[model samples]
Target: MVAIDANEVSKRYGTLQAVDRVDLTVEEGETFGFLGPNGAGKSTFINMLLDFVKPSHGSVSLFGNDCQGEGVAARSRIGVLPEGYSTFDRLTGRQHVEYAIRSKAADDDPIDVLDRVGIREAADRKASGYSKGMAQRLVLGMALVGEPDLLLLDEPTTGLDPNGAAEIREILREENERGATVFFSSHILEQVEAVCDRVAILQDGELVALDTIEGLRETMGGGTKLVITLDRLEDGTLETIWAVEGVDTAVATEESTVEITCTNDAKMDVIVALHEAGLDVLNFRTEEASLEDMFVEYTGAGR
Candidate 1:
């Protein structure tokens, strides 16, 4: 079953087109990541998915139910940790979790939820006194109430420290293992790369790329960077290496070393070509493009 579906989804706010026409589908039990720079319509698209904001054009569905027409039923089956969710100042963390449990009609123990998020020690503390990280954890625990079939987390690690972030990643993994589909949205490419089964990159309010991590690297022309150390460079060495099919770029970075960027399938060809050219293959190391590298290439944001 398709867990979430959006067809030509778009939203405009007066002069601003917050989300351009976009189509997306997430399969059941998949951990999907939504990525984009600020103002790229990620939050807007999420809002449309929750029916928090109406799209100017297009349609969305959750678990085969129309989001707009079946808003309550759709939401009832999902847990959401929205961007900048507000908490009642007077409510304790435990109270917050309990409230979510009650709202969902879920038979959940608030204490267990707090323990799962590693905030049990602060369970009795009023949200007004909670630190940003503690508050973030509290909300996350609330989202875990009843183990909903789907999770929509937007910037879930926003205020977490490194340890807290790691804990969240672990929780996401555990949740996925338990057969829940997770929709994660965040700017932290590393976190998304750590947990997502597949990712979609948004640019200028449109879907620019969508694939598995390695697939995205391939789509963006990101390949293995092979740096070879040589005893000495012979004349025409660079030309000879570049002539190898699938070798995108080859340049001498130093008198004794050359860097070649090429498809993974071409690494051996590059080595063979260099050897055939009478250059000793002293030593070679490869560096794979990280998700961040592909993210920058696709969104043009890191530049």
Candidate 2:
């Protein structure tokens, strides 16, 4: 069964079209990543999925239930960590978790949930006195209370330290393993790259690219970039490097270093050719194009 589905989904406010006509599907048991820069309508689309904001046109379904008509049923199976989520200032951290448990009719222990988020010690403190990161953790723990079939996390790691972010990633992995479908939405590429099965990039409120990471690299004509540091550059080195099979572009970045963008099969050949030319190969490294690079290319952000 598809975990989440949207057809021709669009949202408009006055003269502004927040989300353009877009179709999306996320399969069950997969960790799908939704990526876009700020104001790209990611949050708007998420709101539509949760029925918090009605779409101007199109339909959405959660776990095969009409999200709008069957709002209660659709939402009952989902846990959400919304962007800029605010907790009651008077409630202690433990109270927040307990409230979620009561709402879901779940038998979860508040202490256990707090421990999972690494905020157990802060459980007795009121939210009004909590740090931003601590408040984020408390809300995240609330999301975990019912162990819902789907998790909708919007910038889940915001305000978190590196260590805290890592902890959240680990928790996501555990939840996915327990048969929950995760929809992770973030503008940060590195965070999603580590855990997502497939990614969709939204540009200007339109779906620009949707593919596996490897497929995206191919679409962008982005292959591995090999940088070779050598003792010296030979007279015919550039020409020979270009002639190598699978080599796309070769240029000298420094007096003694050459950068070559080529397929994996051609990387070793370039090194051998340089060695045969009597140049001492000091060191070499390979760099892969990241999702951020592809996002920039597709959105024309780099232009």
Cα lDDT tens digits for candidate 2, 160-214: 9999999999999999999999998987788898999999988888999999988
- Give lDDT per model, in order: 0.88, 0.89
lDDT of 1 by residue, 1-303 (tens): 999999999999999988888999999999999999998999999998899999999999999988999998889889999986998999999899989999999999999999999989998989999988888899999999998999999999988999999999999999999999999899999999998999999998999988999897676466677889988998888888878887766767788898776788889998998888888988999988677767665775422
Reference-based lDDT, residue 25, model 1: 94
Candidate 2 yields a Cα-based lDDT of: 0.89
State each candidate's clash count: 0, 0
Which residues of candidate 2, in runs, are more than 4 Å off? Answer: 225-286
CA shift of 103, model 1, Å? 0.3
TM-score of each: 0.82, 0.82
Model 1 gets an lDDT of 0.88
